[model samples]
Target: MAQFYSAKRRVTTRQIITVNVTDLDPFGQGVARHEGKALFVPGLLPGETGEVTLTEEKRQFARGAVKKRLSDSPERVPPRCPHFGVCGGCQQQHASVSLQQQSKSQALSRLMKRDVDEVIAGPEWGYRRRARLSLAFSPRDQTLQMGFRKASSNELVDVHQCPILAPRLEALLAPLRACLSELETIRNPGHVELVLADNGPLLVLRHLAPLSAADRQKLERFSHSEGVALYLAAQSDTLEQVSGEAPWYTSDQLRLSFSPRDFIQVNDAVNQQMVARALTWLSVEPGERVLDLFCGMGNFTLPLAKRAQSVVGVEGVAALVAKGDYNARLNSLKNVTFFHENLEEDVTRQPWAKAGFDKVLLDPARAGAAGVMHHIVKLLPKRVVYVSCNPTTLARDSDALLAAGYQIRRLAMLDMFPHTGHLESMVLFVRE
Candidate 1:
């Protein structure tokens, strides 16, 4: 039945109605009732009355857009960014911080059918360490416009400042724009990435054409003056080090370095807390063998190695596996090792899978670890910890684990991203 619901649903004509919001959906939209159907209203909160236009109609539920707010909830607060309603980066800025966290916890608890042990939160603003801002040439103003896309629209929002960015990265927005304006070589620029790494700030410029020497000189001067590392990517795989060194960030005692195109958690504080919590929940002892699936660059592998006797980190990307090995050696952790293999496959026959891990840690991408659970069951790990970014997938995978004789022992909510609908959670399952 749940699988059927996950499949595509039919839609019909759009309608407009006044609704009294009763709850919030997983996407942070307000839920209301109309004609025996639940309607989802964007920009509306529970305990509020609003008029909405139904944008999508389905059998189970309907989706709508807020046309007017009749009565606002007490938890509503004015958004900090002037571009809040326009920028696509944030959705729940109008909601108070406490309300946002509460809604997320409630949503996750209901999905997992388990009580949340704790809610891990961090600073609500200026906590974003990474951002990708869209770039376009504005012919009307004869200037380059760089910002997030307009909410639900392809148009780019011209932004001079972003409050959600870290102080250092925020300070560079105007200067970066000024530099881009002066560069005639940059035409129809793809986008710009601002990453506030632990070492310093790094900017990745994506462009179609190769950069000229003059362009490189100008960018080099900008890097030196602003104290930022800059990289240019003509294509997805073609990343050129235009200036400065590759950026690196430290997780606990482990230092992991990567190219600008690589993936890294956007929030540093929450990531550290998550790592600490995961290790604590797993309780990897000195002599226990552990397996970390989808372990990118030893975020948890190196830290776990500090306590475990031998730790194996497996990932699909060979580059990340190499980086993880380097990070382990850089941290002087000899017990840690990494393997590059597709985790979705039957990895039980793999050499690393034969280690007979006593404990396991999984941190898969948004798709979640589906078929991998079968391979994991073969290892007969006593304890399993899952760190998930999507709740629906986590719930589906939990069923698989339960069938394999593992019961959920602990669950916690992670507010990795604030003022957004994004949800990340950690769950511990112990063999019964």
Candidate 2:
């Protein structure tokens, strides 16, 4: 006989418990154990005791919010941002910069089972060259809300100033907000993106509806007065420039032009250092060919081209491939070539891959280069440099290289996003 089940759920009473945090997790959460289950509490530092109320509970793990701190760690410091707790932009502002880097390094070392050779970092504040702010019209207040979202919520928090943003971009917040508030057609604005290019500042506005002539004129005047490059986006793919010239940034003395939507490093200073370090670690000789996978707009490819006999850049995006090719021509790099190919698929069968490479470099997204790891091994490059945004995937992919008799030569943590949970790392692997 089959049994029928009801949809009712169990309810448990809320309980406040004392927790002593023993460690800090990679995501900036305090780690403790309650009844043998891992308990994670945000805003609670290591060596601290707090009264925590469980916000989420599961059989294996639980999450909680600190009600009151019983003790504090010596490394704990007051957050610099006014919206630190409310704004989801930063996570480790409460912890000292040294503590933040130390916790992240320890976490990464445990994961990699190898000590980080170096930590490449830049200014802890005002390092972000690009930012995207959400826009919402408040019917109750009759005002425009422009800012980042609340932590783990869909709600928006109005931000007037952000310390992490570059100085020029931060200063434009008030003027940009005022200009947008005066526009009649901006009732339901989509979003706004600000970028500090080497040339100047650029702004991209996304709107759901078309702008009226008067509103467009006002925006144009604002752009002109502020010396900003303004681009209007009716849809995600469409961009119409109303004012200012094309924006570009220089890296390794090479000027690369990119669209507002192009993906570039958020921190410019660290990017230059990272590029130079990658070249040094690879030790590219002028007589050897190099392969750069997931190369976006030739950030590394063009630089590698300067040092290698020939360089081939493979990207999945067609527009980026075009941009990479355009940048190569713009820089008069004759030996570098860009190809649009799906990296997840078998790239070894491609014509460019058949030519082989003396060294290889790849900078994959958070998902990591799992699909292409085996391919790199099969290519049997002399040395391989892997730049990863996700440590878990990097570790998983590193196993493939290890299995193929490749050993880690160097590993360094890139403090790409400071005061935040995000960590970037680079590893050099050489054939045993």
Best by TM-score: 2
lDDT for 213 in candidate 2 is 93
* Cα TM-score per model: 0.95, 0.96
Q: Rate the local accuracy (lDDT) of all candidates.
A: 0.87, 0.92
Task: Measure candidate 1: CA RMSD.
Answer: 4.0
Q: What are the runs in model 1 whose C-alpha is more than 4 Å off?
A: 1-16
What is the Cα-based lDDT of residue 189 in candidate 1?
Answer: 76
Q: Write candidate 1's Cα lDDT for 146-235 as tens digits.
A: 898887789989998888899899999999999988777656678889998888999988886677778778888999999999888889
TM-score, structure 1 vs. true: 0.95
Candidate 2 worst ten-residue window by lDDT:
4-13
